[model samples]
Target: MEGQRSKVSSCSFVSYCFLFWVQLLPLATGGKVPALIVFGDSSVDAGNNNFIPTVARSNFEPYGRDFQGGKPTGRFSNGRVPTDFLSEAFRIKPYIPAYLDPKYNISDFATGVTFASAATGYDNATSEVLSVIPLWKQLEFYKTYQKNLRAYQGETTAKGTISEALHIMSLGTNDFLENYYTSPGRSTEYTPQQYEDFLVGIAGNFIRKLYGLGARKISLGGLPPMGCLPLERTTNVVGGNECVSRYNDVALEFNGKLKKLTTSLNKELPGIRLVFSNPYYSLMHIIRNPAEYGFDSTSVACCATGMFEMGYACSRGGMFSCSDASKYVFWDSFHPSEKTNGIIAAHLVKTALAQFLE
Candidate 1:
């Protein structure tokens, strides 16, 4: 049914790219990915922040201005986030609802749900800094969701469904920003290299835990080039308008470690399929050549001052915002606009999600 989507230019020409895949879903045997369950931070969060007490909330105007019905749903983008469009690729649903949203119907669970929280990360301390849900708590919530699913579909069916579903885990960026660099608790103990390894080790254990829970197709998003984001540029870019080399080096190092960890996990866990979604490279593609993606503004967000305004600063009563969000790559200082999210996800489906779709 996803192919039946109208040629609405408001959603853009890039969306049409998925129509071919959606049409083939019914004909494919195991080729079609059954579901897409997500876990991580704001990059893929739908509306989990609405239920929690955190400044990372995006459940307001301008955030979801381009989404269906024109209402914000806690997605950091001006429209659908990566998970929403990616779900459409599988004909999973128009959008995958948040796991914590009480309004989600029982049937919604059959397809997929996102368990990500804005600003949370692998380090418990990182989440603690923002009062958002910790990675550990998100896992507990997943256990609860599993029980609910079993209750809804009966144990046998739920088991089969979960085993076949695709899982997306994207976290750790905030660990570098909120913990490793700023928090005395972390900086006092480990060097940057040591901290990256520690994060990777803990994250690897988390992947193993998910595998134990019947997640056969698990994909993890690597850290984006944080230094290339608008926020980083505003704060750290020198006269040349170039990315902060130090931060990018850290992201590259962490991504390398992540790839190795996932490879080892795939080898150790029989029947397991682990994918590494390279947000770093995907983002770099756009950041390096914004014109190729049809974006005009990459230096500032579409909301507020667009320079440093994010989270609490981007509000309705105060600062101004751009009229057209599509032209911009970022919706805020730290998060990409919907168009950019779609571009990044299109790359992910071709690269990281290929095995799952096949």
Candidate 2:
């Protein structure tokens, strides 16, 4: 009995020591573990869209008015996007490169971040709406990124070199916004529920691809309330300032299906961490009660046209511009302001990432 007690005690002591050393790993090293690899649409795009000739690009005036030197780095927001905030909160640098940017080379991605440009959606049709980077293309970029990382760090070290790396994904809104609802090309093809399933299937396939690519930490995002966007609210719909319940319902259905898929993925692919950030619920709550979140104008874009009020075809030079970008919740018809993105980043960092990072 005494011998058994001693063995158990020794095992417990060794486990405690191992955990203690693991906890001290970051602090003992002195420098932070760097590198963030982001993949998503406008929400997390740093400046990849600038390289593309798409009309959805945001590398113009009023886009980066809040950045370090007030230069539009191609982010859809006035300043740093969610990826920047997430990197900052994690104590890494803020300027991550867009994977497609010419200035970015293999070395730039070693310590910095990379945003793959795409109107990226769970559905290809949604990706085609604006000719943004499709999910497959984004995965191809990741393949290139991995190759570059391996070349720089060598094969053995590169096996899982993405320590502390976070794959921040913000997509699927375009699937509903452009494909199912607005785009004439796709609207007639699938019912709203069919579209949701199609998107979820795409999402699942994308996640599986990421898992195969050694993406252990993935933050998949759900759609925001589609009906609440200023463009959606003011469009040809009969209602005034009312969110499109049908679109939101589709999003809800997608979220439910996505949750189930995530559960299955976690079980099937052990050691791969996949989390879904429910921005839909959070954004909807804030939009419905702007005062609660300190947002003064949740329904309008701070840019010239102010939401869909400028028509579905509003641009930077449309009509008017707000003096303070922080005062507004959205930068354009389909994008959120830097402040709002920061808020969402904070929530993601605090909630979705709490378990993984710690």
Best by TM-score: 1
Give per-residue CA lDDT, model 2, range 1-358, as digits (tens).
Answer: 0011000111122223333433443443323335678777777777777777677777766567667676667777767777776665565665577887787787878765665664667677667777778878888878878888899989876665664456667788777776666677666877777777777787888888877777777777777887788788767368766787877888788888887877888888878788877788777777877777566888788777675532124343433577666657777777777777777766776677655555
Off by over 4 Å in 2: 1-34, 309-319
Cα lDDT, all candidates: 0.82, 0.69
Per-residue lDDT for 142-227 in model 1, tens only?
88888888998999988877888888998888999777877899988899999999999888999999989988888988999998
Residue 351 of model 1, lDDT score: 79
lDDT of 2 at 190: 77
Model 1 ranges with Cα > 4 A deviation? 1-10, 17-31, 237-239, 316-319
Q: How accurate is candidate 2 locally (lDDT)?
A: 0.69
